[model samples]
Target chain A: MKKLINSPDSVIADALRGMAAAHPALSVDHDTRVISRAGGAAQGKVGLVSGGGSGHEPLHGGYVGPGMLDAAVPGEIYTSPVPDQILAATKAADGGAGVLHIVKNYTGDVLNFRMAAELAEDEDIRVSAVVMNDDTAVEDSTFTAGRRGTGATVVAEKIAGAAAAQGADLDAVTRLVTEVNDRSRSFGIALHAGTVPAAGTPGFELGPDEVELGVGIHGEPGRERGSMAPVRDLVAYALEAINADRPVGGDVLVLLNGQGGTPLIELYGAYAEAVDWLEGHGATVTRNLVGNYITSLDQAGFSITVTALDDELVRLWDAPVETPALRWGR
Target chain B: MKKLINSPDSVIADALRGMAAAHPALSVDHDTRVISRAGGAAQGKVGLVSGGGSGHEPLHGGYVGPGMLDAAVPGEIYTSPVPDQILAATKAADGGAGVLHIVKNYTGDVLNFRMAAELAEDEDIRVSAVVMNDDTAVEDSTFTAGRRGTGATVVAEKIAGAAAAQGADLDAVTRLVTEVNDRSRSFGIALHAGTVPAAGTPGFELGPDEVELGVGIHGEPGRERGSMAPVRDLVAYALEAINADRPVGGDVLVLLNGQGGTPLIELYGAYAEAVDWLEGHGATVTRNLVGNYITSLDQAGFSITVTALDDELVRLWDAPVETPALRWGR
Candidate 1:
């Protein structure tokens, strides 16, 4: 309930205003709830577009810029953006090369993006989609019918956006996204639940000594809750689950992301433990990010994302990126 | 009392390990507790070095890079780093020109950094110090003798670091830092208290509906406490106080900083409010930063920093920065 917002109803709209003011490079359309690069789509370049519910910030809207997403449509808190907004973003971001819809695997998001793609195609725009289902925490969660997408959404957006910015064809960019998604896996834990602004309370609660493991991004139920242990053990459990499914090894990219509310110091601590665990398992993490890149509101927890990287993916990731949320190598 | 840490005793060391693993561009000396550029000091460049207690992350540590501090020393949570660590960082970061020590105006930190400067003098390394006391919240607090430094540390580091990186001498860099400190003013509000790891609890407490109006970075007592109002009113009050003393006008740079635990969405909302307030008061905010640049450990609130910019500071502000936390134009 202690959130810095005018009202629950205006969080998304007001935040968009703030985003527009803070970053003039990205143009935010209040009417359609779309944030896009100021220059719009480039001719003959594959356009990258993504959208989802609000709350998990710096994900879609924060990623919209030159070397990442072209446009992003944000819905209300933990609710999917309607097809109209998605269609608007798709049309605005589309160039002669085409548009790629980066859809997370939640049921509402996937369905809406799909509908929007169909609508774009009806309007003579070529559209392709890559649905991300990278979270290894659960096969199905409260808001997702399949495995929910989490940290890999960021990894996919960055790499694929770079490929698109390289003037790759639509097919090539879509293939790169598929390759990145195939190589990435994520798992999350929550020390505290994120409060939904509309609800005026946390969706779930934990006892002072309790913690949630294998948590979803929307403050949904996790795999288990237990007495709080040291962060080393928590990180080990999460990474063990991820590496077991993905069989992580060789050169890899890691993102030890904070699930909001957790301080950077603890995220770095978790990053250290995650690196130790991955190295012990014979994985050489060549590139890594440790911060609140993909967050779940103000939930005090962390997520570990391991993406087995190839030279091409590494090159793409190393390319310049300039956005409000994720910017580097520019 | 919930946090993602190993043992309370090992919080700083463990976090340092994580930082070392995550950012290879910066070399972390575990023994001395210093994070410095990987290549050490560049010859003839005025080296910038800073250190303080841990918890306020990305302040000193995250600012060490090509265009920022040459080295950072971190101590235990909310406690001043020792003279030995500061002395070691000074020696490592000192180039032929000199080294600038950016110390926050906490008593222990002032005494420690001053001692280290004397020690560095004995080692024949030129050292100039700038103690920033820019917090407008309180004149004296739990850990400070004078006004405590908060958000302005980041601003001073960025501007002064750019000056030093441009081959400015120690005196020039010191002068630039003093100018930045003089023009910059910051005010913070904590929705909840920050918990120090060793203490196993928040430094203080607030009622469910109450908030500290001008809280210090370490959860020190602020100017006043009142029932939580809409973010607009809260922002107005803080900015009104800052403008009352400084009379903000013309082109100004703003930093709407989140004090850890707040979500990005809320931060952006606060940013929007701050901008509206500033513009309404006849101030022109030309450049701004909205994020968790300087943070209290897991405290839910934010701080507003405004620096009235002249042409020189504006040019220095626009200079390329390639640090782990703050990077742009590179």
Candidate 2:
């Protein structure tokens, strides 16, 4: 388990220090390990915030920007950011217009973020949060965490960021984010496993000939294990699961997401396969995306999310967002 | 050397068939092996095109949409799409507005795209290209492929996708894309190599106690091997390389790219280290992106890309884009 770090425990602290030094425009709350812009966004603008385990790059922290999140709380790799860190983010993002916290649906993430929100309220800072539970891998399942929040986090952040950037009030931004999550559904698969730097080993053992289906981000075992098949069959399985959980509206914002290890070529191949299935089914893919957006550490696989889009949501979706992870029309 | 396919020779063809089945909105030319939207965007709009190997999913193909790219040519995993495929893309994207090819900086990508561009000229379709040679890992030397492009491919795609979406002329779009390539630099590090499905073997070897520095997308050997250090130092090495190569400019767009297998959490961990280094150097991380954008199949590593930005290009970049890969800003 050789890695680029002096010690597993010190990786996060040292990284925070380095980020603080490298980007003068970004200010790091060393005490809390929260990252925000130097002066934070303007006052009177609803502050948008997001936080989670630190492994997903450009997600919580990389997304801290002008048209996006005001600040983000980062936890250690595959670990939740502490309650205190979340509180710090809520406070920094509070611009008198209130704050909205975007959280992915993971047990630790939910608990930690919710606790942070509670702590923020105690501080007299009006903070509202929305949990993104869009992974559609299963329903009424036991053995694992309920449908994991896979790809919807990206949409939530973008839409919420846009609303916040437009000066939408906290309630409005929170509602918008929730609405997007409500309209989104996701399903995932993994070909290989990634290592938790702290654990110093691969998350799971995957025979070279098999891929884990419906795997969670933390290397949670997938729903099924099967021989890797042609891309079309994989698309069929992913779409069947995602489409089954399709939001009521029919119009969908499709996301073909790569788990940590899959390559871009494979992602596109899968996306092409997924879209073909949707089109053949007489379904319309109103908006679509493909890439390694929200990823499980280094698992080799991908997921798909379809967020049904409405005119208002689509407009907000098109709004410029400037984050390290996503920047276009910014 | 474990993979699911029946045979390595069948990978590309099988993948394409699967892609066609999944993405009906995309027309896959079996003969030419090109993937294009079923219907082109505005007829007079300059068409945006890009592509490379099969494993970098969602890249050239997933980017095909309203405000991004019109067509993406794909090759075998980690292999350049042949000249014929590039020609197919050129034809499919040849609306009256001409075409702009966004190519990553690879020896094969360069040779193949250039040859296709020459072929397009013979057909009277005006074609321009911007070769994205952003990786600074391999310094100028006779022993290398001259800086291989890494993460800047995303920046070039997004910005040029915007300009083309805004009805910018082919030349203008091409120029902007080239400028971005010129101003950007990238560096990568890998902990472990991925198994190429086609090759049925690891792309490269890494000792348990070491990692590779300055690697490319084809699983190419990096500049050197060294004992793993703190994530911060690795990031510094990358940022320093990118920063040194970066042209003097205003804001900078930085990308924390995971090679195929590095998990998002690890990518973020790497980001924490890299961004800190970037900030300390007085670089304004105006736009930050962290994810697996450009990748080598399933290699466990990450790369950093920084592109200097100015207001105009930034504004153009802020324009709405809705691709299968990047769908946030519609």
Q: What lDDT tens digits, residue by residue, belong to model 2 across residues B1-330?
A: 534343567666656765665556678788888778888546888988899887765566767776677888888777788998898899898888898888776778889999999999999989888877777777542223667766788888888878887778888888898888878888888888877775677877888878888877777776789777777778887776666666434568778776666655455557666655666777767766655667666777788887788987788776776664565563
lDDT of 2 by residue, A8-103 (tens): 787667666646644566788888788997887678998887878866655677677767788988888877888988888888888888888888
Error of 2 at B266 (Å): 4.2
Q: What is the lDDT, from 0 to 100, of the residue B329 in candidate 1? A: 82
Cα-based RMSD of the predictions, in order? 1.0, 5.6
Best by DockQ: 1
lDDT of 1 at A117: 92
